[model samples]
Target chain A: MRTAAAIAALSALLAVFPFLATAPWVMTIALFTLMYAALASAWNLVGGYAGYPSLGHAAFFGLGAYTEALWFNHHGIGAGLTPFAVLPLVGLAVAAAGLPVAWIAMRTRADVFAIVTITLLFVAQTLAYNLRGITHGAQGVAMPVPDFAPATFERPFYYAMLALLVLALLLSHAVLRSRLGLALLAIRADEDKARGVGVPVGTAKLGAFALSVGITGMAGGVWAYYLSFIYPQFAVDPLVTVAMVLMVFLGGRGTLWGPVLGAFIVAPAQQYLAYQYGASQLYLLGYAALLVLVMLVLPRGVLPTLGDRYRSRQRRARTLRADVGTGVSADTGGDIAADVAGEQP
Target chain B: MSAPLLEVRGLARRFGGVAALDDCSLTVRRSTVTGLIGPNGSGKTTLFNVVTGYLRADAGQILLEGRRVARPDPARLYRRGLCRTFQQPRVFADLSVLENLLIASGRRRAALAGPRVRADDRDRAEALLAEFSLAGLADDPAEELSYGQRKLLEFAALLMSSPSLVLLDEPTAGVNPTMVRTMERHIRARHAAGTAFLVVEHDMNLVMRLCDPVVVMAGGRVIAQGPPGDVQADPLVLDAYLGG
Candidate 1:
């Protein structure tokens, strides 16, 4: 109930933030944050829940971005459609692309699977880079300003992006609460045991991979339009992939709010670094260092650590209340009472 | 009495030069508890793996209910009503006891896409948990379970599949005496309900008490097969168990 109330308040605030309503820079930042959060949440589906670390998620993101770009540039489809209408088509395309990659990679073990995924990112980037005639390759294709009734408005675009992010969060929440989520957790715990009990290990992995890819792809498609350009560099950028993975891990990998928190922190920090250093490389290096530090100090990630502390405090309080109710002397022996108090709080 | 549900004819498996299973043949009757006993390195587990399609056989024909099954995939075998538990109790560590049973119940895949587990499936899972005395631990993660609890959970998980045949690889191994007795009772009840069990165990007392007919193997080949009393008295079985 408290969580729901908090989410509700956060949504209300986001829906009517002063900067988002007034400033173009704020709107752009909002859009970027929303997209990053969505993509990170999507990555969490496979990497966090299924415990399959995929370094090549950019393949799907790039595929979606490129597909949308090509469709809008060549087919005259973007003029008539709403973002919602285009999203499903983008999702379908991305899922189709993800199927075979996941099918093959799902059979491999941990480190081997990570290597395979990385190889896929390279393969996908190469394809996008070389397909110049169709994709505009290094030059990138431009998305014509979307034809809103009163011309393309930045505020409306920001809100649309925000809505997409909210939808992604809700979808992620729904999945985690569903039976599929439980099965994925089981698979993460032990694939062989999961399989022995009749969990279709391959099918579950493929499904998670496809869903994760599709969600990330949809976000990518939206992001491309928001930026008004799509390039191979943007589509399959190693930096973007690293940021997504780090955000998910740092935010608290399997927790729903972790990635959102991660995006809010990391994206703004990257922007600040770019502003101060005038070097994108510095931002990447700093982000990498942050991830390494987070892994070293809080291996389960930030959210889980906080959650554990919160749980421990609650348990201590409960024990204290229980002792009071049982008429146990609060401070009988100095040493033992100190030890008990120490244990409690 | 009746034709065996599973018939292994000249089954053989080799690991490089060493024969893990050499000309191994056996018959497993339906609705009966059959014991496979051997000393360490006697190919009991190897033969189990071969029959269950975990390992490929060098030379063999495995007939399930009189139909030849070759190159049998584990999933296919499962679909064909063969289920197994490992020597070490293997439960999904991150999942709850109920979730483990649900995974084992073979309904998670199709039902997973839905918002919630079906009421009927949940009820069935709860009933199974109660029957196995795991109701209290339903919400606890499988990782928090004791070794004996894990073994019981494994058995409960296997039962969720409602398999026609169950291959228990050391079901009593590492289990406490109290849990072992509980497992024995559960096995008896399950056997009475028409489930066939092929148990691989080292505990002779358990083997003698639970199994009707026993099969003995040595160095990857069956040396003797008969009623427990007769097999125990056989000189070859004694040699395999006690000496050569």
Candidate 2:
């Protein structure tokens, strides 16, 4: 009940944020925050829950961006239809591209899996750079922006990003509660044991990979339209991948709100600090420092650490109640029962 | 009597130059607890692994209910109603004790996508917790449980699957006397309910008490097979295992 209430409050605040914005900068920050939230949430499906740390998610993101760019530039599809038509196509294309990669990467465990994903990022970026005719080589492709008054241009894109973030959050929540989520957690806990206990390990990993890639690809497609331009480096940037991973890590891996919380903190800080100083590299250095601090203070990430503290407090209270001859009851905050409630007997 | 629930025919598995299970053969009768006992390196664990599909055999047939399974895997074996516990209890250390049982309980891939958890699964998990004397620690992570508790937890987890043939590898290795006795009781109760077990244990007293037909192995081959008392009296088994 407390969790549900907190989520409701956060959603209400986010819904009103755009309307309450007095300046263009606030909306700009909001857009970036929403995009980062979607990206982090998408990454959480595979990396956080499945315990497959994919360093090459930028490949899929780039695939989404390039697919949208190429489709718009050559085919002129975006002009004929709304972004809703283009987004799913881009997501599917990126997911199709991710299938073979997932098959190969999911075969490996831990460090090898991470390395395989990193290799994929490098390969995708290289392909994007060298594919001169399609990608326009070093010169970036331009998006045909919808004709609208400059004052209202940000509103549609802001809402689109926000909607995507919300959908991603709900999807992540659903996955966490489902048997698929349980299998992923089992795999995360012990892959061999998960297999021994009848979990189709490969299938679970690939399913997570596909869902994560599709959502991330959708975000990338949205981002390309929002920016109205895409170069190989911009579309396939390793820095974006790092930022997403760091955000998920900082908030809490495999948690519902952790990625969003991480995104809210990191995205604005990265954007504003770089904007004020005109030193993107320096802000990245700051992100690194913050991540280091988080690792040192809260190694399991912020949300999980807080949950632990709450559980400890509940335990103490229960003990006190027991001593006082008061009946001990279920801690509403403790979700172990809820987590395990689902399963075909 | 009845057709064997599991039949291992000329099973052969090798690790480099050494054959762990060289032409090993055994049968678990329907609704009976059969025991496999041997000294260290006698290929008892190897046979269990092959049966449970953890390790592939070089050349052999594993038949469950008269049907030969080809290139068996753990999940496939599990769906076919064969479940096993490891020599070292392999509970999900990070999950709560109840969660450990729940994961093993859900049978179908479709269950992963189901929006709501089944009420019966929760009730069953709670019952298993009580049965295993782990009700108090249901919310605690499996890692926090003592070794004996983990062993019991594993047994309870296997029960959730409701497997027909349970291959228990060293079920009483580190368990306390009370747990061992509870395990025996549970085994008998399940056996009465038509679930067969092929138990691999070093505990002769447990084998004598629980198993109907004891199979003795040494040097990757079964040396003797009879009732526990007859197998215990065999000179070949005594010479191989007890160094008589």
Candidate 3:
């Protein structure tokens, strides 16, 4: 109930944020915040729940951006419902591209899986650079400008990204409660045991990969249109994947709201650094150092740490409530039945 | 009663130069708590792994209810009603105890459960928890439970699927005496309900008490077999335990 209420409150805040911030810079920051939040939520599905650290998610994001760009330019669909309509197609096509990659990467465990998945990012980067005719090489591609007034141009894209985040959160929540979620969680806990217990580990991993990258690709499409342009470097940047991973790590892994919270915390700091430093590399170094320091302090991440504190407080209360004599060690968080080894017949 | 519930014929598995299972053959008759016992280096665990589809045999035939299973795949075998436990009690430590039972609702691929947790599953998990006397810990994470409780949780988890044959590896090892009795009682109750168990345990007393027609293995082959009294008296069984 508490989690549901929190999600509802945060969602309402994001939904109403546009009207409160009329300044372009504020809206731009909000847009980036929503975009990264959506991206982080998408990454959480695979990395957080399934415990598959995919370093190549940027490849899918870049693919989505390029797909949306190509579709927009080819059809001359300038800032309309049709462009928004193509996002699903963009998501599916990129998700299909992720299938073979998932099939290969899911075969390995932990570090090897990371190594295999990171390779996809580099490959996609190479393709984007070398595909001169299709990607326009280093020159980058341009998105059709929206016909909406300049003052109001960012609203639609902002709402689009917001909608994407909500859907991604919904999907993540749905998976978390389902048997599919249970299987993924079991696989994350112990893969061999997961298989022995009748979890279809292979299928669960693949399905999650598809769903995660599919959302990421759609986010990429919205980002491309919002920016009205995309170069290979920005589209296929490794830092994008790093940011998503870090956000999830900061908030909490395998948690629904953790990534969103991380995004709200990290994206603004990142945008601020870019705003103040103006391309100076010092802040980037500082950013990395600060993030590492935070993670080292909160190894389990923010949400879980808070949950632990809450549980400890709960335990303290339980301890205080225990009466005189007839001593009951209610310490195992009220799981007293587990203490009944000799008591059972 | 004459028909074999499970049969492993001439199964051979090798780890480099060591043959873990050398022409191993055994039959678990219907409705029997069949015991597989051996010394440490013998093939008790190896046979259990191969038969449960955790490891592939070099050459063998595995027949469950008179039908041949081609290859070793744990999920597929589990759907065929062959559930197995480990030498150590391995539960999903982070999941709730009730969830550990709910996650094993897999007579088929559990991924096919789609996007919703069925209400019936929750009811079944509650019922199983109550039956195991773990209803109080249903909301607690499995990690918080003691080792003995974890073994009980694992046992209850496998029961959720209502498997015909449960291949247990060292179920009583490292557990307390009271917990051991509790496990024995549960196994007997389940056996009475028509479930067969293939228990790989090192406790001779447990084997003597729980199993019928115990099969003894030495150096990767069946050395002696019969009722516990006869097997205990067999010179070959005595020699394998004492000499090897």
Estimate, for each residue in A167-251, the C-alpha lDDT of model 2 and write its tens digit: 8888888888887888898999888888778887788888889889998998888888878889899899898899999999999
Off by over 4 Å in 3: A1-9, A323-345, B1-3, B107-116
Chain B TM per candidate, please?
0.94, 0.95, 0.96
lDDT of 1 by residue, B56-112 (tens): 998989988888996766666776778888898888887788888776667645777
Clashing pairs in 1: none
Rank all candidate structures by their lDDT, best first, as comma-separated numbers. 3, 2, 1
lDDT of 1 by residue, A1-345 (tens): 998899999988887773435655555666677778888888889988899989999888888888887887777656634654677889888998899889999898688988999999999898888988887778888887776543224555666567667777887788787778877888888876676666767877888888889888887787777667878877887777888889988888888999899888888777666767775576767887898898998888889999988887677666766666676865543445456568764
Tens digits of lDDT, candidate 3, A73-116: 88886666568888999999999989989998899988998888
Total clashing pairs for each candidate: 0, 1, 0
Q: What is the lDDT of residue A115 in candidate 1?
A: 93
List residue ranges in candidate 1 displaced over 4 A: A18-21, A77-84, A146-153, A320-345, B1-3
lDDT (Cα, tens digit) per residue for candidate 3, span B1-244: 3457899899999999999889999998878998888888789988988888889899989999888989878888887788899999999999999889888878355445564457787788898899889999999999999999999999989887878999989899999999999999999999999999989888999999999989999889898888989999999988988993
What's the C-alpha lDDT at position A309 in model 3?
79
For lDDT, the strongest prediction is: 3
Ranking by DockQ: 1, 2, 3
Error of 3 at A93 (Å): 1.7
